[model samples]
Each structure stands twice: as C-alpha cells, then as structure tokens.
Target chain A: MAYRSTPLRIDRDHALRERILECALSRVADGGFAALTMQALAEDVGIATGSLYRHFRSKGELAADVFASASQREVDALGAALRGPGDPAQRLAAGVHQFAARAWHSRRLAFALIAEPVDPEVDEQRLLYREAYAELFSELLEEGRKAGVFQLHSPSLIAACLVGAIAEALVGPLSPPARAAREAGYPAPALDDVSQGLVLFCLRAVGVKELV
Target chain B: MAYRSTPLRIDRDHALRERILECALSRVADGGFAALTMQALAEDVGIATGSLYRHFRSKGELAADVFASASQREVDALGAALRGPGDPAQRLAAGVHQFAARAWHSRRLAFALIAEPVDPEVDEQRLLYREAYAELFSELLEEGRKAGVFQLHSPSLIAACLVGAIAEALVGPLSPPARAAREAGYPAPALDDVSQGLVLFCLRAVGVKELV
Candidate 1:
C-alpha cells in the first residue's frame, strides 16, 4: 500500500509541476516575462505562493525553464520544417517562412523570447537556443553544399549568420513599441514582407545558385 | 567664490566618473561582466565602494554605463567604415571586415557586449546598440539600393538582418568555449575565415550585384 501511494504522489507532483509551467508560459505569452509574478502564477495554477517556491526556488529559475521549454518548441518546429520535404533550399525557405509566420502570430511571446531584457538566466538559455538553431541550419547547409545546390564556405559559420539574421529580422516588428505604433496606425512591415525578406536574405546568404 | 568652486567640483566629479568607467570596462574586457563586481571596481579605481555608489546607484546601472561606452566606440568605428569612401557595396564589405577584425582583437569584451548574460540593464543597452548598428547599415543599404548596385527590398528589415548576421557569426568564434578551444590548439575558424565568410554573407544578404 505504501509503495502504491508513493507512485501516486510522484505522479501528482509531476502533473502539478507541468501545470505550473503551463501557467507560467501563458503569463509570459500574454505579457512577457514581466507579467510572470510568483503570486499571479500561483493563483493561476490554484496553488499557494509557498508551494510555488517549493517547485521553483526563484523567479529566475522558473523563467529559465519557461524560456528553454518555449525555445525548444521553436527549435523542434524549425528542425521539422528544415528536415521535411523538397530540396534543401526549398526546405530552408520553408523553415524561415514557418519561423516568421509563427513568430508574427505570437508577437509578444516571440519578442520576449528573442529580445526582451530579462533575467540573466533566461539570457543564458537564449545563447544555448541560438546555438540549437545554428545546428539545425548547419545540417541543412551541409546537405545543400553536398548536393551542389548551395555554394558556401564554412557551413557552420554560415549557419550562425542565418540564425542571427532571422532572429534580428523579426525582433523589430514584434517588439512592444512597434506593436503600440502599429495599434496607433503607424506603418510597419507586414508578415509577408518580413517573411519574404528573411527568406531572400537567408537563401542568398547560403549562396543558393538561382537566387545569386 | 562658491560658483567658481562649484564648477571645479563638477569637473573633478566628471573626471572621476570617467576613470571609474575606464576601470569597469577593463574589468569586463578581462573577465566579461562576471568580473565587474561593484566592490572590485571600486578597488580598481582606488575609491570606497560607497563613493562608487554615489556615481552609480547600482551594479546594473554601472554595467549599463560600461556597456554603453564600449558599445559606442564599436558603433563609431563601424559608422566610419560604413560611411567612408567607396561604393555602397565596397563600403559594406569594408565595414563587415573591420567589425569582425575588431571583435576578433577584443574577443572577451566583444563577447560581453554582443551576447553576454548580464544584468537586464546591460541587455537593454545591447538592444539599443544593435539599433545603432542597424541604422548605420540601413543608411548604406539605402545608398546601395539607390545607386543600383544592390537589389533588395525593405532596407530597414534587411539592415536588421545584417546586424544580426554579423553579430551572430562572430559570437561563436569569440565565445569563451571557442576561445579555450583555440588556445588549446583545436581547429577553429581563423579570423580571416570568419571575416571573409561574414563579408560574403552580408554582401549576398544585401544583394550586392557582383556577389550575386
């Protein structure tokens, strides 16, 4: 009976932790990391603040977790697209389009993940995730180079450039100030414009023969 | 007499602040922001920590100032190269080459300024400095487009991509682990390799006619 109850307790704890992370992520998506207070997240998860601390020792740790989880999803999605179909160049273009489109649709979360000035812990995660993105691009670039479809030197370095360009390209339009300006009727680049620009920038960067 | 002394006092205070920032920058250059503790900075400046506090309210504020001053120098150097004599395409290549060369020379400081996990204040400065870099590129991009030497859409967006690409490309080769590997005789891309790769990436990204 004791062994059975121990497993049940472990299951309950795991579920609660997952729920807390989900709520924390939701808060961040809605209002960036600034909105993710312990008290608010606890209430959102129907838990006590003390209990929240029991799960996450500090806001930084929790924020880092959220950042990693969210970033992992993006990496996974981009990896799938880049590895999915068509030629390597087409796959690269599809990956960029999917990334920009997803980022545009969730402007706040994207901005938060990409450029929001937050805890150093989250920033650490950012560096790791940027590397993750570079890895995915490097794989595709190697494939393209081998196929003679992409003319490039140092595929790893080129991959890093692609990661940087794509992230920086999206940071502006998704930023809060830009969001406010758009809401106030100022001119801003639409998703299609950003997506198209990024795709061109990346394809040309990798030395796609046709684009060049 | 009071007014005259007031001016002298203000001059002395300003000089001390500059000295403090110099020391702080040196610390960051040697060991990244992790070595930029307020107490260590005070000792470096031969002043009391309390006196340092009089100059900067907090460590974050001090780090931001250091970040700004260092970033401003890079921005100024880059601006000169980008706005210097030659066609827009030539200037663009020269700028990328110069920027990469400078970062390679000051690997630690460049890493700190470019992608360090530091206080939120420093992160804010990073975002602002990135915009400054983008503005310089945007100006040249517009010039290139008008001169019919470069074919691109959305100079602003393309400029951001260039900024991102250049920063990201250098971050890898300049990072601490990369530095350690290089020092230990690991095969890492040399400065020329990175600079040339980055220049090619940027030129192609902006649609330089010859490169294409």
Candidate 2:
C-alpha cells in the first residue's frame, strides 16, 4: 500500500499552518506589511526558512493571505453588525460604529488593510476586500431600500460611497504622521466623534429621514 | 555689479522650468509615478540629463512640485465653482458635478492626482493637497451651515468624508484594471450616472435638506 498520512500528522500540519499565519498577522499588526519578511516569519514561527516555502509559494502569496484573512474577519464582523436585530437605520448605524471602533482599536492593522501602499499582490487583495466590504453594505442597503427606510438610488454606488467615507475618515487618524502629531501635543479626535459623524453621514446618504 | 541677469534670460529660465514641469506632469499622468524619471523627462523636454539636475535638485523634489502644481490647479478650479454665485446648496451641487465630470474626463490624470501610490515626497504632497481640497469644502460647508442650509455638526469632518467619497468613487473607474475591463467588453457606467450619484451622496452627507 502507498504511504498514508495519519490523522494525527494531518492535524499537526493544519495547526502548524495556522500558527504560522497567526505569527504573520501579528507581525503585520505590529508594523505594516513592510515588516513582514520570509526569514522573519520563519523565525517567528520557529521553523526552518525552507519550511516556509512548503506552506507558501512566495512572500507575495503569504502577504496576500495575511491581508485577506484580516480583512475577511472585518467583513464578517461588519456584516453581523449590519444584519443584527434592529431597524435598517439602526443596523446601519450600528455597523458603521462597530467598524470605526474596531479600526480605531487596531489603527496600524486597519491602516495596513485599508490605506497602506503595498506590493501589487497585497494591493490586488486590497481591491478585492474593498469590494467585499462594499458588497456587504450593498446587501443591507438593498434591504433598507426595499423596506422604504432608505430612499437612495443605486445600492452598489451608495455602498461604495459609504466604504470610501469610512476609509478616508479613519485613514487620517490612523496614519503614522497623525499619530506622531498626537504624540506631539496635537489632540486627536475621540473615537465617538468620528463614529458619530460617520454614522450620521452614512445614514443621511442612504436617505434615512430620521436617524435613530 | 557681478554679472547682472537680463530680463530675457530670466523669462527664458522661467519658461524652461515650466516646460520641465509640464513634461513631468505628463509622465505621471500617462503611467502614474512609476513612469517618471529624470532621463525620460529630459528626453521629453529635449534637454540633457545633466541639465535636468540643474533644474531640479532631485527626482523627489521634481515629483513633489509636479504634484503640487497639478493639484493646485484642481483646487483653484474647484474653489471657483464652489465659491461661485448661487445658494449654498445649489453651489455645492454644481461643485460636486463639476469635480466629478472633470475627473471622469481625464481619468488618468485624475487617478494620478487622487489615488496613485507614489514615493514619500509625492505622498506628502498628496496629503497636503487632500487637506487643501477638504479646506475648500470646509469653507463651503461653513457657509451652508451659517445660512441654515446644512445641518452638520463638524464641517471639517464632513469635508473629509466628501473628499474621501469623491476619491474612492473615481479611483475604481480610473484604475488601470478597470480600464482594461472596459476595453475588453465591460460596459462602463455613464458619466451622468456617476456624477448624479456622487452629487446626491455629498449633498445628503452634508445634511442638505433639499437636494438640487
């Protein structure tokens, strides 16, 4: 019989792969993608540099996977918040606030995912994830429109605007220079200020007459 | 006096500097920042590569100046539109439409100015220009708020939202891959569709009661 992989070995392999991804993510979170390197990741994962090649074909592929995994978590979280129990307007507000808060808490990771300039591989993943975020919003927008809670045309386009507004509003505060400025006695706006403004702007854009 | 400069010499020098800037802008517009190089720019301007160094201290400085000059023109044009004769709401709508139309027409240049990833020098100019754009919007927003037209709390925050929305919306359509898709058989959205949607989105975000 051909050599067969045991379940124990398969499980170990899967766990090791996940551990590597976790280490990669933490590196990206601590610094931007610029800090992620194959050798560094291998060392972090406590594996041989040659072993990394077995898990990922290239650095770009690894970076793209890290970006997708992080962004996917965000998209899922936002989706749940938007689709949570409430009126359509309340749900949208909740979703916007949740997204802003999450980004605020993890400013470096958020900036890396949302606005950092990166290699073409990561950049392509960025575009795809941006679309994914927009798609989540579009579904909620459509639901709200059908419920007569939102009076906007083109859910897809409106969703894009919402994504754009959220990213742009947060990028300034999340930037390194902005953080440096805050460290230098420039008071940064509180999270509530940004969240409230973003929610109002997004709700109004969707033609929600009375914000909850 | 030690070798006083003539009026004709000064005029010629000014024109040559302008010419170099023009060539630099075209290079960026054609292929984003990656297409720009001192040697290529000198060839385009019919000057020796050494002459280019005399005109510009470094590539970064040259790129920054090109970015600033191009962005300043956009700011001036947008300022005139927003500050033109009309009520705040009407002027805001006109300004949004004008900006969208201008971006849609020359998408390459628009993408370069709005979203192209570039070196730090150009990126710094990008941030400053973005703030310049937001400042213009903030001024209009203040006027609208004072006139009891806009019901927003923070004009600066709202202005950032507007700029972000505008850039994100246009960047997708202006991206190289999007252009490739359009060339390959995809049907691009009409200019009116994007412009109308964008204008409505901005007006609503600013809490304009009756959209034009």
Candidate 3:
C-alpha cells in the first residue's frame, strides 16, 4: 500500500509545530475558541509572535493545522481500535467503544473547530475516515458472507450505514447528551443501549444469526 | 388532530415574540449568525432592547427561542411532506428529498447551532426536530414493512440510519468543495444513489421485493 510504503521523513522543526498546536489546543480547551489568539498562543509557547508565523501561515492556517493534527490523531486511534484479533463483530465493537472514550475526552476541542475556518477541510478528512472505516466493515461482511456467517444485499452500503450510525450517534449535527451523560457518571440508557444495539443491528441487518 | 382541533388564543405580545423569530430567520438567511445582533434585531422589529430582553432573558435565550421556532417549522414541514406519500418507499424518497432541501437551505444556521453551547435546554429544540424526522421515517418504514414493500430486521434502526444518512450527505462534513460543487450544479448522484441503495438494501434484508 502507498501508505505503508511511504518513507518517514520527519522535519527537524516538527517539534515546534507540535508545540504550537498543543498550546492552541490547550487554549481552546480552557475557554473555547475565544482563548485561541495568536499572541496568546505564542506567549504560552515562549516564542515571539513573528516566530510563530514562520511555522504557520495565518490564524486560519494555524486553526486548520491544529484541526488536522487532532483529526489525524483521532483517525489513527480509531484505526488501531478496529484492528484486533477478534472476529469482525468484536473489532467493530472495540472501535465504537474506543471512539466514544476519545470523543468524550475531546468533545469541546472537536466541536470548537467545526465552527472555525478550517471546518471544510476537517469535513474532507472526515470523508477519508469514513471511507477507511467502511472498507474495514465491508471486508468483515465479505468474510462472514463467505463463511455463511453474514448475508446482506450490499456489503459496502451496509458498512456505510453501520459506520454512519455509530459516527452520527456520537457526532450527530445536533448534540447527543449520551457522551457527556456517560462521562459524568450519569446513567444514560439511550447512549449505552444504542452502542450495543448498533452492533447487534448491523449483524442482524447483514443476515447474521442473532449476535452473541 | 390536537393540532388542528385546538386553536390556542394568540397573545398580541406573544405574536410579536413570533414576529421577532420570523425576522430573525430572514436575517440568518440574508447574512450569517454574525449578522443577527440585539441591536439589529431590535431595529428590524421596531422594538427596544429592554423589550427584547423582556421576552428573552438573554442573547442565548433569544437564540434558543429562534432555534425552537425554526426547528418546529422544519418538523411541521416534514410531517406535511410525508402525509400524502405514495407507499413506504415513495414516502421515504419524498421525505429524504425534503430533508436534503431544508438542510441545504439552512446549512449555515444549522452548522452554527450544532457547534453552539452544549446546553441541554438550548439543544432540546434540535432534539425535537431530530425525533420528528426519525418518526416520519419510522412511519414510512412501518408502512413499507406492512405492504411487503421493504425489508429490515429492525425498521426503527433503519429509519434512524435513513435520517442520519440524509443529514450526513447534505453536509458531507469534510467536503466544502463538494458542497460548492453541488451548489455549482454537480448533480446529487451520491445523494440519490445512497438513499435509493439504503432503502433497497433495507427491503432486501427483511425479505421484501423493491417497488418502483
């Protein structure tokens, strides 16, 4: 794969770029997007404002960079969570659980960036993640179908809906209290049940026997 | 129907309150949320700032009120759109088309609210909209299930997916160029195809034959 074959060539000043993003994320976390100013970020990182500009093009660029890093971090984490020794169902379950955990942690930062100038780019990154996620599920469905363990009309579309359901269940255009409710030690039947039910529904929809 | 049978008396002041909301929607349409300010809104409605606060406790309250009105408007529209639908599948198609049109028209405001304060009370309006949308699809799915026009292991979950997919497809979340492309008249094959495939796959899943 091109991704696997791509050679690693880290820039020497990548540490500074990473530091800038960390400062911005911290600022955004502290007081939403209101706190993420160029001067404030540069001051926090102990660098001159002009020096900071050398690393990033503009405020919009900086916001875009921070979002890309955060998005890539999330996608990598989701990818790792889905890659396991278990059957397709187990892998999907692991992915959803891992996603909810991370989403709960970064809900504010994630939502903040959605209103930033970089939202369109973030959306593009999201499509890539969705495509990759769909591929993962489709393969599992194909495996199940071959083994007479799964049956569905279109493995790809089923995969899309399964992935879409889980994604939207957490990050619906509107707020889903499920994430915050679960984290606050509140009993959220809707959130917990939906996660469990989503996996079961996907299996059943694909013509698998009752999920275990 | 309670809605049709019950004619609640409209208070003059309450009617003015609604007038404020109606104008605010037009304002949000003309410019973005950035354009809707207390001063501008008051001026637009020929009211004093003090009078505005009388109806709304604060700016957030005003936003919530506006959101509630807009959300209800969408719900009523969805309900009306699906009422005369041909069959389950046809009704589903009509519902998805209606949803896409509404979401596209209100993209900016929807994006703003989605990323707004995670206030439960504030978001309740949107939650109502979500439920209203889901319910419409649920009815269509049930109609399809009964008429042997659709297949689904669980109509409820399928309905959720259908609504979620339409929303996602409109926003496509990460593809601004795609959104721009759509505006520039890149035909909505992805949109139409996805909705069609989902409904068909759903029907096949439950052992029903697809109807034109």
Candidate 4:
C-alpha cells in the first residue's frame, strides 16, 4: 500500500509543479521577468516559500524554466505558421505576419522574451530558442530554394538573418518606452506597417521572384 | 601645498582607473566575460582586490564599462565605413564587409560582445549599442531611399532589421561551440562567403540593383 501511495504522491508533485509554472508564466507575461519573485510566486501558488524552494533551487533556475516554457510556446506557434498551407514565400509572409501580430497583441510579454535585460540563465535560453526559430526558418528556406521560389545559396545563414530581423523589428515597437510614447500620442508605426515592411525586407532578401 | 597635492592625487586616480579598464577589456577579449574576476583583474593590475573595488563597485559595473568601450570602437569603425566615399549601395556593402571582417578576426571578443550570456548591466549596454548601430544604419537607409537607390518606407525599422541581421548572422559562426566544431574539422562558413552573402542580402533587401 505504501508503494502504491508513492506513485500518487509523485503524481501530485508533478501537478503542483505544473501549477507553479503556469502561475510564473502569467507573472512574466504581465510584468516581464522582474515581477517573478519567488516569494510572490509562492503566494500565488498557495504554497509556502520553502515549498517553492523545494521545486526550484534559485530565482535564476526558476526564471530559466519560465523562459524556456514561454519561448517554446512561441517556437511552436511560429512552427505551425511556417509549416502551414502555402507556397514557401507565402508561408514565410504568413509566418512573419502572424508572428508580428501575436507580438503586437502581447507587446509586454514579447518585449520580455525578445530583448529584456534579465538573468544570464534566461539569456542562455534566448540563444537556444533563437536556434530553434532559425531551424524552422531553415526548413522553409531550403524548401523555397529547391522549389525555385527563393534564390539563396546558404539557407541556414539566411534563416538566422530572418530570425534576427524579425526580432529586432518587433523589439522597438513593443518596448515599454515605445508603448509609453505611443500612449502620449507620439507617432509610431502601426502593426500592419511593421508587418508589411518586415515581410518586404525578408522577401526581398531571399530573392523572391516578385513582390506582391 | 595640500591644494596642489589634491590635483596630483586626482590625476593619479584617473590614470589608475584608465589602467584598470584597459586590463579589464584585455581579460574579456582573451577569455570572454567569464575570465573577468575582481581578484584576477587586480592581480593583472598589480593592485589589491580591495583597491579594485575602490574603482568599480562590482564586477557587473566593470564588465559593463569594458563592454561599452569595446563596442564603441566597433560602432566608430562601422560609422567610418558607412559614412565613407561611395554611393549608398557601395557604402552599405563596404560597411557590411568591413564589419564582418573585423568580427571574424576577433571571433571570441565578437562573440562576447554580440551574444555571450553575461551580467544584466552588460545586457543593458548591448541594447544601447544596438541602438547606436541601428541609428547608423538608419542614416544610410534614409539616404539610399531618398536617392532612389533603395526602396523602403520606414528607414528606422529597416535599419533595426539590418542591425539584427548582421549581428545574428555573425553570432552563429562566432559562437564558441561553432568555433570548436570548426577547429575539430567540421565544415563552417568562411568569412568571405559570409561577407558576400550578407552584403548581397543587405543590398537586395534595400532594393540595390545590378549586384556587381
């Protein structure tokens, strides 16, 4: 009976861990990584601070976990868009458009994930997730090249450029200062304009046949 | 006599501070930021660790200063290349090639500056320097667009994309693991190839015609 109960206890621990991650992710989505204090997260999780420590050793460790989970979601979303139904160029445009729209909607979280100054651990995750994004773009780029829809010798290098271009393009408009400036009625590019400019820049860079 | 002595003491302190920063930059360039420690840096300067703290309150502060100084040199160099004698397209290509070549020659330092996971203070500096780079590109992009040599609606946004693309493209090739893989006989993109591909990409993206 004790042995059987051990399985149930492990299940309970796993469920509790999942709950903690969900709460932590929400905190980051709302206020960037700065708001993800272990003490506050413990209160949100309805667990003691000591219990939180039991699950994650340090704030850096916990933040890295949170960063990975959030970034993975983004990677998955981007993957779906890139692999969706269309020609290579169309898919690329759709993916870039979807990515920009999503980031525009969640400006704070997107800024946090893309360019926020945070723990080194999160920065490590940034590099990993960037590689993941590049891989997805690599697949589409190679396909585009083979289909004669794109003209590029090195797909991998160009994919990395796309990842960087997209991130850098969104970072400015989504940043807090930019958002504040917009709130104060300062002129700023709208989401459509940014998305279109990025699509054009990427499509042109890849040597697409014609620009629509 | 006291007043006169004060100026001498101030001069000595300033000279010592400059020496400390130069030593710190060398340490970072040689081994990335991981090799930068207060004790080791003090030893390199032939001073006590306590004296090092008198100049820099913390490792992060020292690291950030080194980062800013090193990055400023790159920015200045790229600026000279971009603002040099050429048409918009020629200048852009020249700047890209020069930037890539400089980074290739100093892979480790370039990697550290571009993508190493380090202190938040340094990360903050990264954002600032990236802005500096983007601003430089903005000037050129706007010039190109006005000259009808490049076609782009938003100079600033496209400038950010170019900055991101250049940094991202180099980050992969310049990363430590990639370096090790190349050293171990794995195939890697040559600097010339990268420079040519990057120049072509930038030129095409900006609507530069008749690629020579």
DockQ of each: 0.85, 0.40, 0.13, 0.85
Task: Please list all clashing residue pairs in model 2, or write none if there are none.
Answer: none
Error of 4 at A59 (Å): 0.8
Q: For model 3, what is the alpha-carbon lDDT of residue A212?
A: 50
Q: What fraction of correct interface contacts does each candidate retain?
A: 0.87, 0.55, 0.15, 0.75
Give the C-alpha lDDT of model 1. Answer: 0.93
Name the candidate that leads on lDDT.
4
Error of 2 at B201 (Å): 1.1
C-alpha lDDT (0 to 100) for residue A207 of candidate 2? 94
Q: List pairs with backbone clashes in candidate 3.
A: A123-B173, A123-B174, A124-B174, A151-A206, B151-B202, B151-B203
Clashes of 3: 6
Per-residue lDDT for B166-197 in model 4, tens only? 99999999999999999999998899999999
Query: Could you give the candidate ranking by lDDT, starting with the highest?
Result: 4, 1, 2, 3
- Per-candidate TM-scores read 0.96, 0.82, 0.56, 0.97
List model 1 lDDT by residue over A76-144, tens digit each: 999999999899999999999999999999999999999999999999999999999999999999999
Lowest lDDT sum, 10 consecutive residues, model 4 chain B, at B1-10
- Candidate 2 structure quality by residue, lDDT tens digits, B94-153: 888998898887888888777665555675677678889889999999999999999999
Candidate 2 lDDT by residue in tens digits, A71-95: 9999999989988999889999999
Chain B alone, TM-score of each model? 0.96, 0.93, 0.72, 0.96
